[model samples]
Target: MTVSLPTISPEQQHALQAVLDEFGKTLPGCSLTVASDSNVLFDGRSGKFDALEEETDSPRAASKEDVLWFASTTKLITSVAYLQLVDQGTLTLDSDLSEYYPPLREATRRVFRGTDDQGQPIWEDSHTAVTLRMMLNQTSGFGMEFLEGVQGWKSYSGKGTGFVNSCKVDNLIHTPIVEQPGVQFQYGNSAEWLGLILPHIVNQSTEDYMQQHIFQPLGMRKTTFYPFGPEFKSRLMPLRFYDNEKREWQVLDQQMPGLTLPRSREEIEYPVAGGGIYSTSTDYTKLLQELLKLFRTSPNAYPKGALLSRESVQSLFQGSLPESAKGLLAHVMNMRPPQPGDAAATGEWDWSTGMVVWTPADGRRLGKDTAAKEGGWGRRASSVGWFGAAGTMYFIDPESNLTFVCTTQMLPGDHPSVSTMRNALEKQVYVSLQA
Candidate 1:
């Protein structure tokens, strides 16, 4: 189902341009693009591609080819890669994680048994075993603090020392499980562990398997697990984040004095699969497009060939959270409060694979229903994607056959630039569809 590109109305074009301009003024150095099912509706960039301190005030133009780190957005890729193995019968989703890593087999399954000496958990040992499905859905009883807290797990710090000393994959196996596997949703690096498991099953390194099976086949030329040499540096846009003290945004350089740089090859080459990818908007969009095609059309949706069966895709999207997870991990993932008409009030959503599965009533939380009413077309549901630690986001909307990508560089995560850029782009998409 190839759709023809729609012509943009003058009003819609002006509205989009205005929003892009505002993003430039507010974010400092950033690039953005909005596309319909058929064609790019808007593309714009402002700020220097390199370190701002080295470049002049004359902002360098961002182009379609400029690559930006997709960050945690790489989780979707890791998820798909794992699913491919499942499809090939290399591993089963229900397989016990302890089967591969034997130490986990004996690790205590800790459950909340009330408060302890320091008001911590008084855990009781359990008989249930953690499985691949539970880990993929973020119900593996892993603690979120390892990734969220400032000092908990500094393995992916890019400093080269923390990963070797304190953040090794083996360390996670002995870490306490806060809840029973498949009991709740606590988003973190479980998927990265799953990535580590892939190489063991397929008899190849994660990078090699991804390149041979996914990236090369899908034509994701700019996507890589580790940073490319200086040749690729010319294509990368400098990361930017807002600095409240200066009342302006600052551009980050190679040293990343106050920003997040791409993870070093040493950090990524290890089993830290969850957040190791470096990608461009173009490369990431292709992966999203492949997922969109699978969900909207058929499992054999790609021009290259079928990546996974339709049934497999359905299984990936179904709920993996258990009833006991209600108050614990769910609150973290569902940050938005229940709106007046939210289906979550009726117990409709559940954690599935690498994203939250939204029922129709929960669509408002993601700005989908509002976009539809405003005449913007995209998936109100039946879509899922995530961003990197450094303010990167992507989504594939099956309803409208639209794949959206937004990339930026910001340190410490949760920088205002991410939300500001996403909201502006979403509004423009809505306005464009209405026109």
Candidate 2:
């Protein structure tokens, strides 16, 4: 099988640069890498690191080496690691997770049905068994802590909110399931459970296991669940918040709540599998490129060995949602912040093993709906991508044989500015491909 590598021409590079320059004016700093399966097409950055910009006397230029908190982007990596267990025949996606982990069975898996008339909690025992597929694919009924119902459950149950970002098992046990397992897509602490159970399955700490299996094999040397060490403190990109009223980027006084780096060995627990990795663009790209290669190749012709088997890699892009959950999944994806100057709903969204998979809406496939066809951030149908809470976005388009990673350190992950920047960059990637 011959796969011709696509190159980004000078004119296309110029157009991509223009996107960074245009949006960079509002963001504190951002870096973007566009690459083919085997080569980098465009690698560019705009703005300055807040740490350097603060030094008014002599501002140090922001380098491409800067590390950014990947937030939910960490899920893809963790998902791959868990799938590796399946590849080794140690775990099965459809097996009841409770049967494998007694803790899950010990904890009551009740569905929160809201308060009774007297303001008392109403709960229903869920007979539906939770599976690894449900957990990784966002259908485990675990609602994110920030969601209104989940927060209400926390208050009613007298559970502390700090566990939301603490990377503890309490994140899953203490949190209530909003729906029955395998019924709907409720994005929350489900991935955190992967972090909790993965160590037990592999007989080592998640950090050690990932370091041995994923980080080292993929050459992600700078990526880690623990990024607060003295070694990383200097290279870490500071978190920033955009002040809409002030029209300027402000360095956040504190990092996102519940995020703490361990100073001593004993203090380390399971790393936050949902969103606790810090990585540079180059380091993260290696993983994407490797996955892209496996994605495009047949099972018999997988190029270099990867963390996941070719079958597992295929699962990453294939829709895993049941018929019952498709509507909810589409609604959730469509709820993203509106891109500037663009007024079309994102068509037909699905969750694969890890990330969001954009597909053609019913009408789009028949060419009856023009808007649905244009709504996938300019990436073709079946493109897979997801966003990080800290203003980071990436997508891999096998149809175009291109992948893109853009990172910025900003709060309120769904801020319009961040989406606008990402949307523009994504659209430009396709434009470059066509040219």
Candidate 3:
């Protein structure tokens, strides 16, 4: 199952570049790479690595080599790492989390009913058992400590919200459950919990395990949860916030909120597993390509051995929600403002292992009708994809046998500019593919 490179005509390349320039011009910087398995079809970039400011001498133009914060995109890698554990019989998807970590057994599952007349928080005990599957699918009732529901829980319990970003499991474990397990889909602390508890199961730091299992194997040298040293800083894109009044992007004076700058490599302790990795578009494309390979090829196809079995990869891509949770998941996906020139919503989405399982307008499943005319706006139905909080996004489309990675260093990831660029770029990629 050797993958051959797909050729992009010169006309198609030019058209893709034009889309990048037009849609990506406003942002501080952005890069997009579209590929199938091993070879890149198109790579285009626009804007500068840093927004031009009075203090800036010469801003570096955006390049494929730029290191950008992957933010929540790190969750996919964490998910992959844990799935590898499952492959090795270290744990199963149904493994009760309490068995590995006893605190979960003792921790009371608290659901916030609402506020009482005196502004006190009403609560209920959820007796549902937490499972690895529930954690990966984000149905574990974990709420982000900084968000509204969890914030109220913090006030009511007198527990500080510092644990959300501190990356410490002890504090994170104490964060109250904001909903009942297996009741609904809430994208909160589930990924972080997956990452924190990983070390306990593997008897190694998360960084080491991921390096040995995922990053090193995939040759993603630039990707890491702990991105330290001057070399990384020199290439890292500074997080930027757009000022509507000034009509310009402003560089954040400090690291993104909740992230503390590491003084040195040794100072790295609790890495924010959910949103802490820094990576280049090139490095991340390797991961996407590897996933595509796993989805399309068999085990013996790799002489050196694949990262995970095909069955494991299938589990990662398959939708995990039951009928009960689909309504709530759709509501969350619809809350984001639609990107300009975006595809019409099918009003359908569900959580896979660590990605969103989006049913394309065509409703075609992979391997069902290979001859179907690939009718879809962007991604094919059932494609597994997710975005970083800092505007990075990637999707592995098994139907088209393609993978896409777009990177930008902007805050409030759902900013219309970033979202529009991502959607437009994806549409253009499909256009080029058709050509």
Which of candidates 1 and 3 reaches a greater lDDT? 3
Model 3, span 1-435: residue lDDT tens: 443455678899999889888855567668888888868887788877776542476666888767778888888888899888888998998888777777666553566765788998787878778888888888888875556877776666665445555555555666667778887788787777777777789898888898998999889989987666666777777777766667766755453455433334564456767877888878888988888877877656643457887787888788888777777777776766334233234336778887888764458532223443554356777788888877888988877788999877776667777777887788778778877
Cα RMSDs, all models: 5.1, 3.3, 4.0
Q: Against the hidden reference, what TM-scores do the models get?
A: 0.79, 0.89, 0.88
**What residue pairs are clashing in model 2?**
none
Q: Give the local distance difference test score of model 3.
A: 0.74
Write candidate 2's Cα lDDT for 1-435 as tens digits.
244688889999999989997876557558889887789899988866783265376555567767788888999998888898899899888867776567665443788877877878888898778889999999888876667778777777776456556555565666667788888878777888778777678889888898999999888889988777788877777777666677665656554554433333355566778888888777888888888888887767775556688889999988888878887776666577334333224346778998888666532221122454443436666778888888888888777787889987777667787777887787777668778
Window of ten residues with lowest summed lDDT in model 2: 361-370
Segments of candidate 3 deviating more than 4 angstroms: 1-6, 54-57, 108-115, 118-121, 166-171, 253-269, 298-304, 337-347, 360-376
Which ranges of candidate 2 are over 4 A from the true structure?
Answer: 1-3, 51-57, 106-108, 168-171, 251-268, 303-305, 337-347, 362-377
lDDT of each: 0.59, 0.75, 0.74
Return the TM-score for candidate 3, rounded to 2 decimals.
Answer: 0.88
Candidate 3 residue 268 C-alpha distance from true site, Å: 5.3
- Give the TM-score (vs. native) of candidate 1: 0.79
Candidate 3 minimal-lDDT segment of 10 residues: 337-346
